[model samples]
Target chain A: MGGLTVMQALAAKLPGERFLYLGDTARLPYGTKSADTVRRYALQAAHALTDHGVKLVVIACNTASVGLPYLQEALAPMPVIGVIEPGAAAALAVAPNGPIGVIATEGTVKGGAYVRAIHAHSTAPVVQQACPLFVPMAEEGLTDGPIAEAVAHRYLDPLMARLPKPKVLVLGCTHYPALKGVITRVVGPEVTLVDSAAITANAVERLLDEKGLRATEKPGEHHFYCTDAPDRFARVGEIFFGNPIDPGAVEQVDLQ
Target chain B: MGGLTVMQALAAKLPGERFLYLGDTARLPYGTKSADTVRRYALQAAHALTDHGVKLVVIACNTASVGLPYLQEALAPMPVIGVIEPGAAAALAVAPNGPIGVIATEGTVKGGAYVRAIHAHSTAPVVQQACPLFVPMAEEGLTDGPIAEAVAHRYLDPLMARLPKPKVLVLGCTHYPALKGVITRVVGPEVTLVDSAAITANAVERLLDEKGLRATEKPGEHHFYCTDAPDRFARVGEIFFGNPIDPGAVEQVDLQ
Candidate 1:
């Protein structure tokens, strides 16, 4: 479902580029699962995309992004990108000095992908917090009320209280964007929020331009696929995608 | 993870019965998946349990309970029980009159298993509200405090305003038991809360006694298995199970 947000970003950035989205809804929420399990599922999903003959594969999900290296190795010669690097670079571009905050799911935080990615470029102090409830809250569409604000405060107050204070707060998880309103209020006005979806879209656009792989077509069609619950995906997915998902366009597929 | 609560209930009721528990942690939160996908996973899990030579099978999950009949048919002649029926029976036993309420995940509520199960015995009015956020809240250990109370009010206030007003509220999902305190406060003292875990345990106990299948052994061993993240299963699982899980006892298995 979070991938829908990235897909929308990609669509906005490169209008003529086609997209084939595969949501592992059946075994969703790779966020809380083990790294090994997430890696295996990510590989399987990437394989499905590779079989579809796409020019590049963007792992829109931050948790799944932890397996980018393994995915790049497994699908040799094919260009693959994950949200973490672009997000990390984007955060550093705005706040190159020190104290960057990252809020993602448990798996993403545990994987330390964002922290490592940021450190690879700069020695800025990175603070990470896992907001497990944000995904469900976002999905439930309780974006800004008392409950959302309360939960956000609970997760972010400590992160905000850290020494030096974070100038940039990375919305590392795609789902986090939905709760942006409450998150902004919780983090206050000083923090510049970085949305990985848009930044990753920018990264993909740059890569495509550099590689001369930009689409020449006037427009492109969007194809949606999931492992299960096409109806719910097409419905709730509209919240993330910011567009109505045609029920007929959503197809269900099984992955080994 | 919710199944762990049910497992704890079963262990309490049948101390002499050995158990083989499987947590489909890799593809958990079945609450949101389609019935077909959940049914397929349930069948696979049941097959794994059947191979272990268990005398009876209990579908501890309310969402997976939607496939109880199919599971019972698939594993014919093997006694099978689902939480929904037992939960509904218990709800009716307490509130024989009309206007009973049920709170569960989206899939479980959409399945209308509780409504059908309750109506199977009487013509009572079954009001159901899908509390999708409760599962994550419970898992995150935010079962109390202002946030919990706020979320409970958000979900329950509408149900409480119903025409007849539900006299008995059934906690249809296993994860719900953890939020019993907040939920009790929300529904007030006038409403009776039916815990599916305890009721299902009683049903299983009765079935075992009637069939002369109660274990003669003095004590029983509990084996915990999951598709992924044994460490997490032992850690977060303690919140649901109400007991510290042995890290060494947790084993990871693969499901087809």
Candidate 2:
């Protein structure tokens, strides 16, 4: 579902580029599953996208971004961009010297993809917390309220309380953007919030320019695909997509 | 997984019954998925369980229970027991007269399984509320807190305030039991809370007894199987299982 947010960002940035977005709604919340399982699913998803004649693949999901190397290798000759690198770069650009905070799903935090990406550029003191409840809260439309606030406080207060308190906080999970209001309130105004969607979109544009694969057309059409529940995906997906999704337009594909 | 809760209740009620519990961790939270997708997944899971030489199949999940008829037909001759019927029956047993409040995931509530099941027995008015956040709250160990209370109040308060004022509140989803404390506080003491796990367990016992399939052994061994992340399942499953899950004992199997 968060991938919808990334797709929205990419559409906004590269208006000429046609987008074929795949939401594996059936085996979703990859953050809770194992790395091997996620990798296998990611490969399947990549293959689905490739089969559709997609020019480049964007691993919009933070958990799936951990398998960037595998996806890149498997989808070789076809460019693959993951959210972690762009998010890490954006966070470092904002706060290169000192502390950075990252909040994502358990799998992403445990995989340490953001941590590794951040370290690759600059050695910043990173404090990572896994706010597992945020996904459900975001999906349930509890993005703002007492429940959201309390949950945010519980997850963020600890990270913010650390020594040399984080100068920049990276919203590692795509769903985090939906809860941006509550997250912003909890993290306060001083800390910079890094959203991977916009940065990843920018990265995609740069990649297109470098590879000379940029579409020459003016405006491009967007097609949505999901492994299951195309109707529900189109309905609930509006939250992350930031646009109205025509239920009839969404196609159901079987990756298996 | 909520199925683990059903497994726990079954273990407690029928000590002599050998149990084979399968947690579809890879493609979980069937509540949010489409009916067709859930049915397909449920069939796959049922096939996996039947392949293990299990005598009977229990669709412990509330969402999956919507496909009980389909499963029963597919796995014919192998008796299938779904949680919805037993839970609805138990709710009716306590309050045979008027209103019943059913709280479950979106899929279950949308499917109207509990309502149909209850109406099948009596003319009781059923109000169903979908508490999408409870599953994550339970899994995240925020079962009893201000956050939990707020979420419960947000979900239950409306259902409780409806005309006729439900005399009984049914915890349709297995995960709801973990938040029983908060739910009790919200719904008040007058409303009797009905948990599907225990009721379903009793149904299983009665079915075994009637069919002469009850084991003669004194104590039965419990084997846990999951589609993915055996280690994480073992670690986090304690909240639902109410017992320490041995990581080494939990085998990972491929249902596909």
| Root-mean-square deviation (CA) per prediction | 1.1, 1.2
- Report the C-alpha lDDT of model 2 over B62-177, residue by residue, as the tens digit: 99998999999999999999999998989999889769999999999999999899998899888889999989888889888788888888999999889889999999999999
lDDT by residue (tens digit), candidate 2, A148-219: 899999999999999889999999999999999898998899999999999999999999999999988955
TM-score (all chains, Cα) for each model: 0.98, 0.98
What tens-digit string does per-residue lDDT give for candidate 1 at B1-256?
9988999999988888888899999999999999999999999999989998889999989999999999999999999999999989988988888699999999999999999998889999899999999999888898999999999999999999998899999999999999999999999999999998888899999999999899978455688889998998999999999998998888998997
Per-prediction DockQ comes to 0.88, 0.86
| lDDT of residue A19 for candidate 1 | 95
Q: Pick by lDDT: which candidate is best?
A: 1
Please report, as a residue range, the 10-residue window in candidate 1 chain B with the lowest summed lDDT: B216-225
In model 2, which residue pairs have backbone atoms overlapping below 3 Å? none
- Model 1 sits at an interface RMSD, in angstroms, of 0.7
Model 1's chain B TM-score? 0.98
Report, for all candidates in order, the number of backbone clashes.
0, 0
